[model samples]
Target chain A: MLEATIDASLLKDSIESLSVLVDEARVHISPEGIGVKAVDPANVAMVSFELQADAFDEYQAEESEIGLDLTRVLDILGVAEKTDKVKMKLEEDSRKLSISIGGISYTLTLLDPSTIRAEPRIPQLELPAEIVVNGKGFSRTIKAAEKISDHMSMGVEGETFFLEAEGDTDRMRQEMPRDELISITPGPARSLFSLDYLSDIAKPASKSNEVTLQIGNDFPIKINFEIAGGRGKVGYLLAPRIESE
Target chain B: MLEATIDASLLKDSIESLSVLVDEARVHISPEGIGVKAVDPANVAMVSFELQADAFDEYQAEESEIGLDLTRVLDILGVAEKTDKVKMKLEEDSRKLSISIGGISYTLTLLDPSTIRAEPRIPQLELPAEIVVNGKGFSRTIKAAEKISDHMSMGVEGETFFLEAEGDTDRMRQEMPRDELISITPGPARSLFSLDYLSDIAKPASKSNEVTLQIGNDFPIKINFEIAGGRGKVGYLLAPRIESE
Candidate 1:
């Protein structure tokens, strides 16, 4: 017997919005946190998601777990009539998860949890620099970069934050000074990452008016947002392109 | 003179798809059929499209015939983007007819065409006695219905044709006679109509392998199919539904 209440519609919407970017659905769940790790097929980019369990209305499980085949769960949730309370029952066989709402019943078979790869520990970074900006401003800045190039270069100096994209035929640049920045107190650092992945994940994060970004030299960029008063974090590790001159 | 060739992506895809559902758009052109129409806002769905005429290798316009908004163009082509050969040019200020691949471009702007309404004229029917079946089977039977249900519905005394729909909960039925009853005999006089419309309209027609149908009462009971084929022909329609109750 499993009982929990959440804004399933909101959660489903966020997942659907993020799935468009990467694959290999692996989400991490621990007593303290829940996270997701997905690397694009090319392996050039990886999106690591971490959310504190406090965000859930009631997250109860005798044992912490990770689940795969999220697509089926997503489909089942999508077909739900609305964002009403959803109840999930794990049959004794432990092979299927039955999801029910009002009267609709959808049973989704689960893969062996053991078969999924373990989430790798993201290496800690020592480099210095972080900036907090209005989530809307950051999302808008990345969306603008899409028109110029698929990749974006970001940097910080003192209080100013910068986003830049340059291609042979086109170029785009947006700068938000400390005063204009939602909240910024910067150290010196810079990095470049794919605008496609950033834009895609930014979709769910955009719901919040503000977000905090932690940046470092050539290291994974961490973006944190608040959802339901609980912290929702997305760590985007993008491999820097080596220019051959 | 501004002349450049776009690959014909947008116009070709949009017009071909739209023409299947909508009949016309407003921007008046010299001819009667070439102009496009807008889909009803409430009933019409949105499709994201972006293509520049410059992408093509050849583009020539002596003058601007019609400058249309994206929404207006989308509605005119009810179902948009069937094939890729969309070509456009302005002739006289009053007329602009762009030739699409499947059919000739006609010019006429629908007056308040955005209003969703039932088709003006229901086809006349003289069909008698109809049968119900699953959509897939109907689709398949129509293929054969062309040959069998053609001029015959072998009554209880007839050899080939018979109708049946079974059970209170599990509804399933089939009618296929063994002998020439499946062949030709105009004496029985079943019904006559093109399968083109069924081939075009009907969204639910494709969802189930079997489409539950009601046949011949007054007019043909419509069997809507998920739209297929580039031309936008009805996937399935039976005139018998009209005469049989």
Candidate 2:
């Protein structure tokens, strides 16, 4: 059983972050907050999300697990104003969640948590480099790379962080020096990742003021950012695609 | 021989007004101005467009007729900033138009004028009722009507002008009294038009501050508006659909 009231945009953005990685998620509701851990069907990317109880105007929940169809909820929230307050409640014996916003109310059938893929354990990584950059700049760089190739390389050399993409006939590169970046802890970190996953991650990360990226040579990259006015947090882990000789 | 310089947006909007009805058009370029009259493939709608010489920053031309692929020109103009100045030139012996905008230049091949359909002769119509309405409000009404049916009815009743549509299961109507409209001339003028044509015409009409609509009982409707800061004018004539008993 759970009940909560949150800002429409806050809830929408949070759900959007998760939806970019997975269509359906197993949401864990606790007294403190809501959490979701899921991996893409290809197992190439994983997403971890958390929304604090303080993010909501009012919140109450028992420890419970439920499956949610993110797309369906997004469609319903499409009409809501950013300033709207969305109310959601689920009774102990009810299999449907009641959602109300302004003059409209929707009864959303809840998916069974058991039917979803079990949450995967997030692996620990101690990357040698970390960079913080404005989300818009990062998103722009990813878009530029997309025009050149299907894969892009990210690395730190000296005090500069660079993203480069190469196609058979075209190549593009964007360099962000320490002065341009919010911050950078430079190290010998260079990795090539598929633009497919980075492009998807860029959608949610672009809304953030600061996005943290940690990378290692020939290893997976870790991206973290805060949302919902820093009351919620999201992290993405994308495995790098090995370069072909 | 022809050479002209004009605002990017003005040229784009002018071509857009004609492109909506026909993909290729025989454009008549005169020392005084440019004109195009074309009918849609279905021959149910006609467009008459004119861009005065005064609309261009620099204009010079000999009497000429050229066939232009509207879509191709629009695509080239898509990258231009609205404030950019577009320069166009055609040599007496050349079949290509040299277009320059900002730092980019494109040589667009001109279609043979003889290959395109002959310019249509615009029929004269003296409608009994005339209505002047805000372009935005008119566009909104057409959109709402689209949601309900494939066609809509427009007519003036007493002092009120009404736009309405009815589908098998839904209906929508919008009424604008004289106080709400710029002006309205009431008459026994009511006709139904295919939304397919009106919706396309609405694209350019929606950009004008005021659009004059002339209608007559069971007759085609006439729509006229100005563009390019009033230096350009466009007119449309749509054959009315017969309502079966």
Candidate 3:
């Protein structure tokens, strides 16, 4: 028997927001972390997510640490009567997770954790430029980029940051002045990435006004947001488009 | 000239939520009453929504109406810089709506208002049975029903209410005892409907914990949710599925 308590609504909202961009059917869960990885059906985009066990109120598993289908758990959690507290219990068989909230109880079956595979990490590179801005500002910028094109090119110069997207039908650009930004430290950086992925990862960041972003030329961008004074980091690796001659 | 002021975040959030279930390309807007309507591609579901002028700090129009490609408006609204106030301006000649918030400005072109068709209302429904329950609870119940079957049968006996779905591979049922119900006033009848339609209409209800449902024998079910304390209504009209002999 195992038990843990958390703000049911908070966790549920977070999962719902994230699951929109990633599949919940196959998620990786471990004592150290919980994550998901799926490539877009078009094979052009890949999404990977990881949540450290520290994110949990009580992370415990005696011997059976496993992956579970997040879709079912999210479904059960979605129906949970919203209340201040949510309690989770693991039965002896370890095949089901029982959730209780506001006097309502729901039992959700788990899938074989072994079926989920770990996402391969891309090689790390030294990002050239990093900037810190309000999380809300970053989200706004990406959203604007989305209107012009599905892909966007970003770069930093001195104190100015820029996002540019141009398509056959539309062109959009957003430039943020250095003074308006929380912090802008220029370094080596210029990259083009999928705006859709950036928008999805920026969701949690939208909750807060402030966030920090690390950018590198043709490398993964790291966006960090503060939750309860701690940090939640979303690292996005976008492959550069190869121009056909 | 048209201008309106609202809590930038609230309007943004509400519209975003509505956009998920609505196709952005074709949505009709009317000033006769502040409302929007759109028929789903399949014509099986029609979403009717109205937000009272009170929800806005300033609502003014010169008896003018317009139809907009919701995608453009939503895109602009989604990117509005977070500020206390959002300002909107409409230009007649250019046929563009300009939005400004937190010093950022966006312009979206409007579609020909004439092309937008208003949703026709079925003669006032004389629903026989009506029940009130936690809005969130009802949404969850329907979600569960969706998990088991595409069509759900809803019925009431005295005070007891039931939702049942049976498929070749799965069957799900949810029962609410009359005693546990918030309010149950028996009227004319029971009905079966497409779970898909119910789920779409139940979205706004999730914001509130209470909802009212009206059912008539083998007739369309009407679900109503209050927005801004009865000032606004979001309703749905879903055709009933005929059972085969």
Indicate which candidate wins on lDDT: 2
Q: CA lDDT, every prediction?
A: 0.49, 0.90, 0.66
Task: Write model 1 residue lDDT over B27-140, tens digit each, in one string.
Answer: 323321122333333332211111233344465433223434445555545443544444444434333444343354635332442343323333444444333334544444
What number of backbone clashes does candidate 3 have, counting pairs of residues 3 or more apart or in separate chains? 5
lDDT of 3 by residue, A28-91 (tens): 4555545555544344445545555576667654434434555666777766656557777778
After superposition, the stretches of candidate 1 with alpha carbons farther than 4 Å from their true spots are A17-21, A28-34, A50-54, A57-59, A64-66, A243-245, B1-245
**The candidate that achieves the highest DockQ relative to the unseen native structure:** 3
**What tens digits encode model 2's per-residue C-alpha lDDT throughout A1-245?**
88999999889999999999899999999999999999999999999999999999999999988889999999999999979999999867647899999979998999998889999999999999999998977876776567557999999999999887776643556677899889999998999999999999999999999999999999999999998788889999999999875
Q: Each candidate: how many clashes? A: 68, 0, 5
Error of 2 at B143 (Å): 19
TM-score of chain B of each: 0.30, 0.98, 0.86
Runs of candidate 3 with Cα error greater than 4 angstroms are A1-140, A150-245, B16-21, B24-33, B71-85, B101-103
lDDT tens per residue, model 2, B1-245: 78999999999999999998999999999999999999999999999999999999999999999989898778667756779899989857647777776534456668899999999999999998999998888988899899999999998899888887989999998888999999988888889999999999999999999999999888999999999888889999999999765
10 residues in a row with least lDDT, candidate 2 chain A: A166-175
- In CAPRI terms, model 3 is classed as incorrect
* Fnat of model 1, as a fraction: 0.00
lDDT of 2: 0.90
* Candidate 1 chain B: worst-modelled 10 consecutive residues by lDDT: B164-173
